[model samples]
Target: MLFVSTMFESHYIGRFAPSPSGELHFGSLIAALGSYLQARARRGIWRVRIEDIDPPREVPGAANAILRQLEHYGLHWDGDVLWQSQRHEAYREALAWLHEHNLSYYCTCTRARIQSVGGIYDGHCRRLHQHADNAAVRLRQQHPVVSFYDNLRGEIHADERLAREDFIIHRRDGLFAYNLAVVVDDHFQGITEIVRGADLIEPTVRQISLYQQFGWQTPDYVHLPLARNAQGDKLSKQNHAPALPEGDPRPVIIEALRFLHQPDIGAWQDLSVAELLRRAIDNWSLEHVAENPSFSNALR
Candidate 1:
C-alpha cells in the first residue's frame, strides 16, 4: 500500500479547481472556503485552477466572475490561475507517455454499447488493436485502486468493478476526460493536498491509480460536506442554485463557516473580510467539519 503522509511539510500545496460552466454559487463557496482555510491553516499555498476544458459547456464570462466572487469573499489564491484549456500540450504529453508504455489503448466502444453491458466498460477494445481514428484512449487498469484514505472521511472504498474498469483518458470528441486532466494538472502543480466536496470522494481512487501509473506522488485528500437545498438536492448550477450575493459577503461567509461546524463568530460580524478570514484560518479544524453528504440548513 502506498502510504501518504498527512504531516505538514514545506511543500504543502493545495488548490481549489472550479469549472467555468456557471457562476459561483453557495456550494462553490463552501468548497472554496474549505480549501482556502485548510491551506491557510497549514501555511500552504492555495492555488486556483480554471477547468475550462469543455468549451461547449463553458459560459462566456464565468471564469472572470468566479475570480471576482472569490475576491469579494477574500478567498485570494496564490500565484497565477492555471487554466486547463492552456495545458492541452501537457495532457497530450502525458497521454503519449502512457501509450508509449503500453498502459493505454484505443477504445472504439460507444456509449450505447457500454450501456448495453450494464454501463461498466468491459475492456472490449483492450486487445482489439483499434486505430486512434474516431476512438477514445483508455488507460489499462493494471493495478486497480479499490480504496484510498481521506484525511477527513477516513478510508473510502469504491465499487470493485468501477475501480478496475479501463476508463477513458481522452474522449471520442477529441476532448480530454475530467479524470485525466485533473490527475495531470494536480501532479503538474505539485499539489500536496486536495480539499474539496465529499461528492468527489469516489474519484479519489481513480486519481491515485493515475498517480501511481505516472510514478508521481499522491496528495492527501479532505472531502468537505456538500451544501444542499431543503429538498435534499445538492446546490449546483444544474439545479439552478442562486449565485453568491454581489456585495457585502459577510453574511454568506458566516453562513459557510456555520455550515462547516466552526465555532460561532457572531462577534466578528462588524469586522473586515480579511480579519474574519484570519480568525477562520486560526480556528479551522478538519475535525469540526460534518461528515454527512449534505448540510440541510447550510443556506439558512
Candidate 2:
C-alpha cells in the first residue's frame, strides 16, 4: 500500500486535464469527478488544465465549453486553468536540457517505416546524428521502465517493445508530444496524485521513465475504470461521444457516482450539486471502484 503522510495529505494536488478536441462527455465526467472528489476529500487542490497543444485536433470553442460544463456540474477548480499552448517555452527548455545531456536525438523515420518494421520504433535514428530541421525529436531510452504499480489496478507490466523504443517528444511538425507535455506540466503543477482513466495505464511506465530521466519524483497514480460504450469502445470525442447535458446535471452526476460503484444515495437526488458532492467526498472509497472498466449506460 502507498502510505500517505500527513504532510503529503496537506499538500496533495490533483488535476483534470482534458484535451479540448470536443465537449465533455460521460467518460470525461467520470475522470473529472474522480479527481475532484479525491482532491476535495483530502482538502487538496483540484485544478483544471486545457490541453490545447494540438490545434488541428482542438475544437475552437471546446475549451470554453468544457469550463462552462464543469461549472454547470459544480466542479469548481482552484486557480487559473493551465493551457498547454501557453507552456511551449517550458517544454522547449526541458527539451533543450535533454538534448544537452545527450538524452534525446533527432529521428528521420516516417510512420510507414515504423509500421513496416513492427509497430514499435526500433531506434533507427538513435545513432544517425540527424539534423532537427525536418525530423522529430525522440528521447533515448537509456533506462527502460519494465513495470509500474497503479493504486487501483495494482501491478502493471510494460510492453517489452514499447518500453525499449525511442518515443517521440517533439513531432516533425513542431508540436510537442503528449508524454513530454504531460510530464512537464504535471511536475510544474506539483501534482501529488494522478487520478485518471485506465486507458492511460499503458503510458504510466513511459512517464515514470521520463521522471527518472529528469530526476523528478513520480506522483501516485490512480487509474479509474473506464466507461465504455455499448460497442465496447471507450467513450471519447473521437468516438463521437455525446456531450454532457447542459441543464440540471444532477442525473449525470448521480450516474457517475453509480459508475464508480459508490454506495447508493438515491435520496440525495434533490440536494444541490455542492451538497451531493460533499456527501460523495465523505463516503468516497477507492476500494469500492471496480478493477475492470464498466460499460456506461448513459448513452442508452
Candidate 3:
C-alpha cells in the first residue's frame, strides 16, 4: 500500500494531467498555471502526467508540443513525467484487485441501448460475473459518493442521481477508462492535493469513492474555474480553441496569470521565463481563483 507521510500530507503536491488530443490552448494553460502556482505557493512538488492512454484520439505531435508549451511558460515540473500509456500493467493489477473483490463486473451494453433506457447506466451487469473474455468492466457503485469538499469552492457535492450510476472502468474495445487509470495513477504518485478545472468536479466524488474502496487516502481537491469562449462555451480542443502561440509565450503567460486574479508584477513582454515564474510563485493565491464554473473569454 502507498502510505502517505504525515508531513507530506500536511504539505501539498499538485498536478496537471492533460490529455494529448491537441496542443495546449489558453484553457489548458489556465489549468497548468493554476496548478503550478498552487504547488509553488506551498513549496510543494508540482508534477505533470501525460494522459496518453487513448491512442485512438491522441494527436501525433500533441504530447511533445504540450511539454514544450509548459517549458515555454516557465512551468517546470519535478521528476520524470508519468505517461499513462506506459503504466498499463499497474492498471491491470488494480483491475484484477477489483475483480477479485467482486467490485467490478463485465458490461457489454452499447451506447444506443443505454440511451434508449434513460441516460444512466443501470446495473445490468453487476451480478453477471461474466469473465473479461469479451466484456467491458464497470465499477458497481454500491456505496456511491454524493458529496465532497473543495478547498477553493468549499463543500461541493455530486448530483445523487449521477453518483449512484455505475460507471465504466474498461471499455468494450479493451481500452482502460479515465476513472480507473486516474485512480491508479494518483495512488501510485501519492498526490496529496488535486488542483484542476471545475469541469472535472462531477468526477471527483466518484473518484473519492474509488479511493475509499481501495482503502486509500483521498487527496484534497481544488477545482478552479474554467475558461470559456466568446460563445460562453468552455474552450477545448474539440471546440477548436487555438493552440498557444509557437514562440515568445511571455504575453500569453502574463495574461493567464492576470486571469487567475494575480496582480500584474510587470509587463512580461520582455521578461525571461525564470523571472516571470519567480514572481508568479511569490504571488500565488487561492483567494484569487473564482468559485464558479466559467470565466470570461479574455484569454483570446
Clashing pairs for predicted structure model 2, backbone only: none
Question: Distance (Å) between predicted and true CA of 80, model 2?
Answer: 1.0
Regions of model 3 farther than 4 Å from truth: 1-11, 267-270, 291-300
Superposed on all Cα atoms, the candidates' RMSDs to the truth, in angstroms, are 4.3, 4.9, 3.5
Candidate 2: Cα lDDT at 26: 98
After superposition, which runs of candidate 1 have C-alpha atoms over 4 Å from their true positions? Answer: 1-9, 291-300
Give one digit per residue, the lDDT tens place, for model 3 in 207-296. Answer: 988898888888998877778899989889999999999888788888788778787887665668888888888988788766333542
> What TM-score would each prediction reach against the true structure?
0.94, 0.93, 0.92
lDDT (Cα, 0-100) at 221 in candidate 3:
88
Question: Residue 121 of model 3: what lDDT?
Answer: 84
Rank the models by TM-score, top first: 1, 2, 3
C-alpha lDDT of residue 77 in model 1? 93
Error of 1 at 271 (Å): 0.3
